[model samples]
Target: MRFYPATLSRLLAVAALAFSPLSWAEQAISDGVYEIHYNAFNSSFITPEVAQQNGLMRSKYRALVNVSVLKLQDDGSKQAVTAIVSGQAANLIGQAQQLEFKKIDEGKALYYIGGFRFTEDEQLKISLSVQPDPNKPAYNIEFDQRFYVD
Candidate 1:
């Protein structure tokens, strides 16, 4: 079998440049400012007076999150913020331009805060609630920081 049309058009241009999608879209995720970490857990450890004495309206959880982007390289060295974690919710996590909280310090168990800047890239929907009898969860946790300018 002799087939030659410039060798079948060079084997179909090397199989269309090896099945290109622009070579995997240049590893996506670009358009910076990202620093997000969220955690939610209730693997049947339900304790809100035992989930309202077993009347449990709704309680089931497991959410672990992390997203980082703090690459400041001009002199003041700081380059350790390259993250990705999902239980869902993270197209860019709050899309940051600014989300200041820079420091709260105090951790032996858990309380070490510093959250700021989230230059948007879209896809960040978060909703969490837990309250029962003067325990906690009155409402105070909101974030929506999206930025993409130059």
Candidate 2:
């Protein structure tokens, strides 16, 4: 998991000791210079303290989306960079909900997270727009995710 924030690991954890299918599945994308990593999972797995401190909704029906941007340097090292990330999630039935992102800043490391509601066994199509830098073109990515409520 390529998380920028120090407390992100504590926030995004698998429900069980094993790697369940519904675990945090982080994915990455790049346009040569910029790398964007993102993932979405049920918010209930996060501890109450972590959730409260981060203003995350910790309910079975709530889900959170995490996104981080990195810039590739000439030395082949990735540097965390701030970016504007916004998106929306739409269910299979075409019900769309806008995602309001909250920036979590941790010194040099920072990331954007958004929360949305989901139903049991609900599958949603997530669409995101990432702009790591104004000089570069904006990145758009989409994926489908299924959420289960315990």
Candidate 3:
């Protein structure tokens, strides 16, 4: 499906999550009709204005996980879909913290963001349960990433 330029613009405006240390690709899980995109990065990369606007704390020890769900239309366009998402992040030391997601609905561009704490050079396993439709089962997502304080 075609991910519109406007959608990216809005997502960046709201989340500003694309700014990472250098480069980090957003991973996607697809089930033909639906696609879930997610990623995690240090929140300090976020601009101060945007972080405050979103009521988020920017710190070296803090990170953010971003999730977005979309549906593929017949026209090859991607339409943002509302979803039920819950998750948690666990460090290698078995320290698990529940991720409380806050939905950012921009009408056509929707996303869920969760914040967590970590130390320098710490690795975290993030798992999320995403249900794009109440009638369907939730998609289980798990991934690992290392965060740095720099």
Which candidate should be chosen as best, given lDDT against the real structure?
Answer: 3
Tell me the TM-score of each prediction against the true structure. 0.18, 0.85, 0.84
- Cα lDDT, all candidates: 0.27, 0.79, 0.80
Judged by TM-score, which candidate is best? 2
In candidate 2, how many Å is residue 113 off? Answer: 0.5
Predicted candidate 1 versus true structure: per-residue lDDT over 1-150, tens digit per residue: 443324322332332233322332321132232222232222133234422432332223221111223344567554544222212232343332222122211121111112222222333443321111134222223332222211
**Structure candidate 2, residue pairs in collision:** none
Off by over 4 Å in 1: 1-28, 32-60, 75-150
Better of 1 and 3 by lDDT: 3
Error of 3 at 30 (Å): 0.6
Candidate 2, residues 46-115, lDDT tens digits: the string is 7787777778788989888888888999999988899988999999989999999999877766678898
The worst-scoring run of ten residues by lDDT in candidate 3 lies at 14-23
Model 1 Cα shift for residue 49 (angstroms): 24
Candidate 3, 1-150: lDDT as tens digits: 344335533545344344443234547889889999888777777667666666777898998888899999999899999999999999988889999998877677788889999988887899999999999899999988888885
The per-residue C-alpha lDDT of model 2 at residue 148 equals 89
